[model samples]
Target chain A: MGKPKKEPKIKRKTYIDTWRFLFQIGAFIAILVNPFLNYYFHVKVIQGWYQSIAFGHLWFVSPLEGIEALLITKIIYMPWIIGMTLPIIVALLLGRVFCSWICPINFFYEIMDRVHKKISKRSYYKRKPLFTLPRWILWVALVGELMLAMIVGKPIFVFLSPPGLVGREIMMAVFFHTLALEGIIVLIVLTTYLISQRFFCQYLCPLGALLAFIGAKRRLIIVQDMNTCHQCGFCDRACPWGIYPSRGEAEGIYCTNCGSCVAVCPFNARKFVFVGFTPSSEKLKLEKVPSGRQ
Target chain B: MKKENTSPKDSDKRNGEISRREFLRVLVGFSLTLPELAHAKSKFFSSPVHTNALRPPGAVPEDLFAGKCVRCGRCAEVCPYHCIEMLDIRHGLYAGTPIIYVDKIPCYLCMECTKVCPTGTLKPIPQEETRMGLAVVDKYRCITWKGEGICRSCYNACPYKDKAIYLDRLRPVVNKDHCTGCGLCTAACPVTPKAINIEPIYSFKVSKR
Candidate 1:
């Protein structure tokens, strides 16, 4: 033998991206199935959709809806607070995973993103400069929506919310044998994928903005093993949200935990690591990695 | 190529730091538009009341219902009679909000809609306590009133038959206090344009009858 045989490295079997995709698909099917169960079978076991859902006696409202009710009604609604608990805790830990793993609108948006990527190869497709909007614009939009809701004294943004519309439209189609006029809003937002990936989630969604605000100091975040990373930039290309994980530009609020970067990393260097457990230098060294790569 | 890669991120950081001019500009624009937006919301987004259309039993007054309702579609999903339908986009701000088309399908007063309401917009109330609307019988349209024939359809169809509707000289008479306005009579009425109709008395959209 010319040299001792090298041992093959064992790859981790579970792909985070695959789990995320399954959850997204499951959420889409659940929206469709909830109404069907109610209409045909009269199963009152599970009711409602993303905006609010009730499981038998236990019920929960979306955090955005909860906050709107709180502000508009100006009363402490305990049930809404109770309903919002699980989502808030998840956001606090996982950093907008609902956007990637659960939102029905995002499920459709991901499909549109794939189509956009394929068609962009043609000369005619117009692509917006990636990540041009300042992240605070999301906060501004959110605050503006809250103010509008208070002014209108209604849950005004729910009318424009894509996820809300998708759920309500499906319920309308199944139970009432007609679709609502607001279904047009979902169509319009999906069409924007041709201009930019995740345009609605990034720039416009008040619900996403609220979740991002709650997840700003999220525990689980993408951290690179600087020693192993070769500055290959595969993560940058893979991240449809335009988050550059290889360059350590994984802004906590913007990263949806889609795991596209993790899936694309040839070196197996990028990972979801809790910032609390990681050393201060490893966490703070995000700034130094780009200079070294350059 | 690297410059292109790095520049947007750098510019993004610079932009994130709110400039004084930018702050002032946004403040001015928001304040100027606030009043106008509020006025338009009331003027244009007001819910319209339709005849034979009633909110599910236990619904709050119409004005508060819009603000409190999250449009969850739970009420429509749980109706055993399939009487509840959400208002479509044509209804403007009321779209996706639940309503009962009493003429087409009357609420059976299963009280399932009230139980599933996550918002207290539809307070959970018992069937006998339901104050959905008051059914009004059209004397001119009623067969007994016309002397065309003796009809007890409204009297027979009423859930609280003896209490809500009673036959007086073979003509159906409505007792407003007892009628839950479930609209079973309207659905059962064989006449065109219905011999009786449910009017949502609690809704601001409908003027006092």
Candidate 2:
């Protein structure tokens, strides 16, 4: 009788994971040093003196703001109009992988998680529904704010934005002013993140949620092979968002495409796969057989 | 053998059920309270200050005010003159927005803030296109107008080569039309109280007005 084939073992480390970590560290250092560089060196001189380039401008034009601004301003600048619509296009292509890999806030959240694990002596931390409730509430508020801006002529959400808060700190620091209030605000945000892995990305971030919805149906989804899964559930345990990869639907709305689960998986069952969009499939096929199998 | 094979399927079915329930709970919860939350949000929307009334001419569009602004401090970081300061009005929802007050630090209309706005919040306007507001001379505070002394600081400091503050036979008078409202004149006016001030012109119509 032929010997039964054993399930393959997956490597713990991957290139993407290494790159993600390096990017996170680099971004954090850059954010910390940004103020000093602006003040002393005048490295990237903006027209307005001493103003950090980050806060004064929008990274992208928000659709909600763009449509509302149209009614009042009457002058629809095309470039900004185009910039706001680009996120929807990008989301359709890549699924909010940006949130997991590139967001500076997510990098901070990961750091906070490590600290939380050390201080609380708990490896697994789950967020309460009460915390998640605010995300949806905020989204509703954003949409409502836009509608009101259209009817009543006002934009409300700009004030409470996290980016705006950070911008204020950078500006104050550049001017040699005390950033105590900004520091306190940052602490509150960091504390919330420490309690829950990706607390803002999963729950509070409207952009992340919007991208998730747009990309959910895309074929390129993270999947696991049930037959090969050792039920070690390391992938499940490693998931920052607490998703069970073995369950076969990596289509969970909260997935940030961070690849932590892929990094820690002992068996090479889990892999990113495209279902419909792309004709060819590329998977990280495992080479070594599982240890304890006949 | 049959029981072993069936157990995995049963477990899969159970997991599917749980997942469905979780998804439904999240969806329903979001749907039910969305309207109420939006209603509450509408109350906080402050009307846009009119463009003409805006003391400065380059009033950014309202849509540019949405929360997509990453606020990386790039604008403040790159400013050559160190004029812009990000304000944190943590009270009543205006907690983190960056507001430039001309009195403390006036914008030079250099277009640096607009250039760095990656998100189009600060739409880039060219230097020639940029208009903040008109500078109006407060005659009561002017040394020459008040007859305290013949201080021509405002006229000398006017960046507009033509000089918006002209001495009408050497009695300091402000030509409101030519005033670009750069605040150089305000900063230069030599008086105990100071004279020149740039007030926002109201362009958009207001309900109260």
Candidate 3:
């Protein structure tokens, strides 16, 4: 009987959140140990935190910090330019993946979200205070922060950024044997988790705003196949940002490419596709997929 | 939950290019910030000098330090002597920036902080070229200068002892030309309200503010 037509191996799908969680954990540990490595072990390889980090003489500065430094100082510092290239390029290609994958603050929020879910028995998005901010407010906030930095004559957000502050706290605790009062801002941001899961990322956070601005036309994006979608709200529920992948609302600027929606799709309708390539070929590829699984 | 369908035109109108609402928001943000900018002439955000607090060797001019420093803490991390300490929130705009409390811990002039500074906030320079500040012996407070006792504490502690500090008539005299302001003399001063203090004269232009 032709060897009983060996049963076609059914591939089990894995959630993308698994990879994302692993990355988040790795990033957190890296930040925690970076100062220790530099101070105690004399490892000169990696230095600094998320604000501006260096890898063995190569530097990488956050676009927001670089821009603020540029506006206030009005000097096109070479290191700032060299440091900003990788992040800007990554933003252009991947669409805010730094927010989802590397930001230490986001990792903390993810953990907080789990605890929140266990206690409340519902998603944070479903709670009250549905006051959604217009995306344009991000632009205003960015402009406002720049102006404040110029007036203040300092990188204002460096003092207030949660990830930077977290790293600074660790560094100071290690070197100085004390915590700076700036940890209060980190505490304040963390406490806001009781209100909403990603309140800072959505309404505040100029760094996220700057990244979203750079990644507005990102190449890698979540594209929905309408034919096979079945109008299921699973992706909508799965998205932490509250963008509706089913209703074609997942735009590049707001979407962090966390792949949560892709993970939760039971029908496998949502996928990360390079949309900037040949549109016709992409459409053909999407259409070739069967409508639904038996 | 009711699912509301967003048409392409609706999404485009809300998100595409610049809209009237976006312009209005920008206007509001500008209005809010412009007044603060005008008020900043009072120097509310500038770094103010604290007594006994000094920047590391090879530090940029005080005026440019705040704007240039990213506060990455690498300067503190690399200091073999661990003399660099980041300022806390109480320091206002200079919070998180590095400072050496000369009385608590003096810079040894190892030049390591300068080597690791990524921002050029602390410019790289040779050990002898470091011009943190000029150490000035407070004659009235000094034991030798005040004729309390012929104390050679500061002279003995000075890194460039014979050049930066010398005993004239068996009383220590600081030569400003040679003093690199490493602050070892200040830390070694055997008196409360230290006899030898770094005046931070090099940073006077901004520190005066």
**Candidate 1 on A48-128: residue-level lDDT in tens?**
888888878777788897788677766554666788898899999887988888999889877765576587775223345
Give lDDT: candidate 3, residue A39.
75
Model 3 interface Cα RMSD in Å: 2.8
Off by over 4 Å in 1: A1-14, A114-131, A277-294, B1-44, B205-209
**Model 1, B1-209: lDDT tens per residue?**
99999988887677558889989999999999999888766645766555788889988777677777888888888899888888766666676788888888898988988877887778888898897788888989989999999888888888999899888888888898788988998988989989898887756542211
Score each candidate by Cα lDDT. 0.79, 0.55, 0.77
Worst 10 residues of 2 chain A by lDDT: A46-55
lDDT of 3 by residue, A1-294 (tens): 112333333424856887899999998887788788877888867777887777778878888877777777676657668888999999998888998899988898888756666897754234443466676777788888988888767879877788899989998887777898889888888777665667778778888888888898888877776555566577777677656666665644688998888887766667777765855655645543332332
Q: Which one wins on lDDT?
A: 1
The sequence of per-residue lDDT tens digits that candidate 2 reaches over residues A83-128 is 5566556566667765676555677777765666588775444443
Instruction: Give candidate 2 misplaced runs (Cα > 4 Å).
Output: A1-12, A45-75, A116-153, A180-185, A193-195, A274-279, A282-294, B1-57, B60-75, B90-99, B114-130, B202-209
Per-prediction DockQ, in order? 0.30, 0.16, 0.31
Model 3, residue B183: distance off in Å is: 0.4
Relative to the unseen true structure, what is the C-alpha lDDT of residue A99 in candidate 3, on a scale of 0 to 100?
Answer: 88
lDDT for each residue of candidate 2 in B1-209, tens digit (9 for 90 to 100): 99998898887665535576789999999999999777656533542232222222244533434333333445556666776555444323333344555655666667666766544446566554544656677777777777777877767777664556677866766666666666666666555455777655422323120
**Top-down DockQ ranking:** 3, 1, 2
Please tell me what DockQ candidate 3 reaches. Answer: 0.31
How many pairs collide in each candidate, listed in order? 0, 51, 0
